[model samples]
Target: MKTIAVLGLGKIGSLAAVLLRQAGLQVTGFDQAAKALHDIPVLSDDISSPEVLKCLCADHDAVLSCLPYHLNAMVAAAAHQAGIHYFDLTEDVSTTGFIRELSARGNSLMAPQCGLAPGFVGIVGASLVAGFDECRSLRMRVGALPQNPTGLMGYAFNWSPEGVVNEYLNDCEVIEDGERKLVSAMEWLETLYIDGVKLEAFTTSGGLGTMCETYHGRIANLDYKSMRYPGHVQLMNFFFHELLMRERRDIAGEILTNAKPPVDQDVVYVHVAAEGLVSGALRRSEFVRTYRPIEIGGKPRTAIAWTTSASVVAVIEMVRNGSLPQNGFLKQEDIPLDRFLETDTGRLFN
Candidate 1:
């Protein structure tokens, strides 16, 4: 059996271990916290430590990290040293760039930003361009929302809170006039209606993956943003920026995590729109996907967990199936759209 090691057994990491084990890989997990993995064995080691991570990677065919964005470089470096394929779900632009540089010369694959936004969002965007010849504009929006929002924030903690704050504060990368430009985060707000329910979308970091780089000079006015219920932007901005909670992210995270509970009845909303000429005719293609809570093996998993896990699983399958280059950096756009939507796990989005 192929052996795989997962670093960081947090919420997402824990789910990933279960999914990979179910997929028939011999899995070993390492994390700072003592985790419950049912029948699977847990390896007590700190992956953030370079020495220990290198040793752990030495015995595994590949290393999948579910740690925060800040810890991704450490794991990537260790994976590079151990000659193992490295994969992560980070959306930090700088971190993805570093991973790209490492992939340029590495002997094994390094795939990052393989989560919901940079992950599945990229796949949808590329698919849109494939069907249209003279592409005009492409818009992609996604949200992991609580089914019953009961707080002033009107949200719950489904994923990384720190990751949420980083995305809000960072400058977003966009493609306008067929050129790359950095747009101020939280600007360019727009109201959207999904399923006849109103929601707001705005600039957020790393949701576009290398789309801007891939679609540059090919299309104009291509952008990606995060979606939230109406008034979420104004409320969050007041708390994050005005209250200066932006600097105290850890505190803000703690407060939110303590006040707002994680909900099982949550949904993941995906919307992709592409406008261009098809067969010498002006046209547009729009795909909207919403994943609700699903029960796998009597356990209820949120849409965020399902979507996020599938993102990494799909990419890993692609690499294993020889659909992607075995060595060096791999961009999300490097994976074909149809192939992605055709994979056994990829069909979940459908």
Candidate 2:
């Protein structure tokens, strides 16, 4: 069996290691915190140290990074130098660009943005676009929210606070009128209804992954948004824009993280829509799903943790079985949605 090393034994990483081990692969974990991985054999190594990071990744066939977005570059470089494949769940565009550059010079695969929005949502969006003869417009939306919200924002810290703040503050990339453009986050707000629950969506960064470049001139309009409960965007806009929190994202992240506690009972929502001409008539296709917390390895995991971790693990399985290209930068859209859901790990979304 192939051996894999999972870095960052935090919320998503711990579950990812569990899934990898349950798949019968030899799995080793590493974390900066000593107590992050108590149930499994792990090394409490400092990821900031180049020599130590390289040594930890050198023996593995592939390394999955669940560390914070800012730390991905160091880990990715180490994995590349160690001649091992690298995968990460980062939604940071700048980090992904760096990994893409590393992949150009490395012998092993380097895949970033392997989590929910840029990951499975991109796969679903691409599939919907493929159904059209002439694609006109496409929109992808995803959200991880508390099932029973108690806060003023009606949200919780389901994932990394740094990631959340970064996406909200960064400029978003989209395709408009057959040309790629950069738009402000939290703009273009719209209301959406899912399963009779009212929610809102707005432009978000990095969720589109490489889709804009892939479908730039081919489609007239394309965008990705983050969905949230009603009134969430207004409060966020007031805090980030009116209060100038956008300029101080680090402080903003701290305030939000401290205010909104992470919840165990969370849900993940995904929706994708494509409109274009099929044959001679205009047609629209959509994919939608709501994911709840589920039991994995005899333990109940939050929906966000399971969905995010499952996506990266499924992609790793695909790489191991030679289904995906193994020697270059990999995009979420490269994996077909049907094929992804068929995998043991991807089934968690079903």
Candidate 3:
């Protein structure tokens, strides 16, 4: 897996290629047009064709897709047929399900949901209770927001607006009171504090990945949510419900992104907690951090960009070095947090 090809040279994709190259791997980028991003060699080609994608993927040992979720099934299918390992940052549950099915028949690894909320957060949640006797609950919350806000929404489209919308509208999976079930998104609301800053969290889809299935019998309660500034969720509920924007997610996403475009000065907050019995005593473990835009390749990148990109890059690094399984459907909960932090790119999270 020394030679890697990154598809979709957008914000996260371009930065991921730079990080992979920085990790000492041979990196190439692909997109609709050939354009230089940082120091990586980018090639322009249409990946919509299965034949073209399979041919392109065969040339590399692995393929990392940073494309939108709607196009990932095709990419994974191509990778499967090419007998090359595949990775993606998709948070779409259906897309992950399709990839999981594809992985069953393929010899190479198919890893998806390798981004921040579903990726690193899942890894952290499992690590928090690794030594517990009886895991009680695991709660995870993540947010990427404008550092300085001046709007009713108090957000910026630093991440994929489509992804944000999907998380809001889609039903969330959870394990409540030892029973696994589906719950309406945005129904469970809670207030949390980090460094004395108040914020709100609500249920969101796909953030839990496959954790419900993995922790069904082991954990009593488990859930994931998205954090936002105070009053942010209220406005969203009103906008989607009262204004009837839920019927048209595409248009809603477009309108939201245009109103609050991405900002250079942004922050990403991650807070995770797990409670269980340690030594016959109730104990709680927490992993909390606030990430801001940092310098990469002598230029600053947004917090959302670096966190999301570095996450998958580190997982790929581990895969290349044999720290992770080489084939089959890789679960984020199965990745050891210690080994993940030992990787070159994963160290950035520290």
Best by TM-score: 3
Q: Say which prediction, candidate 1 or candidate 2, comes out ahead on lDDT.
A: 2
Give per-residue lDDT, candidate 1, residue 177: 84
5-66, model 2: which lDDT tens digit per residue? 89888879999999998776788888767564535688887778988887878788899999
- Better candidate by lDDT, 2 or 3: 3
Clashes per candidate, residues 3 or more apart or on different chains? 1, 0, 0
Tens-digit lDDT string for candidate 1 (107-202): 898989888889988887888788887899999999889987775677888888888888888899999888799997788899988888788999
Runs off by more than 4 Å, candidate 2:
36-39
lDDT, model 1: 0.84
Ranking by TM-score: 3, 2, 1
1-350 per-residue lDDT for model 3 (tens digits):
88899999888999999999999989989988788887788888888877779778988999999998999999998899888999999999999999999999978999999999799999999999797899899999998888898788888888888998999999999999999999988879999998888899999999999999999999999999999999999999998888999999979999999999989999999999999999899998899999999999888898999999999999999999999999999999999999999999999999
Candidate 1: regions farther than 4 A off: none
- Deviation in Å, model 3, residue 179 alpha carbon: 0.9
The TM-score values for the models, in the order shown, are 0.96, 0.97, 0.98
Query: Each prediction's Cα lDDT score?
Result: 0.84, 0.89, 0.93
Model 3 local distance difference test score: 0.93
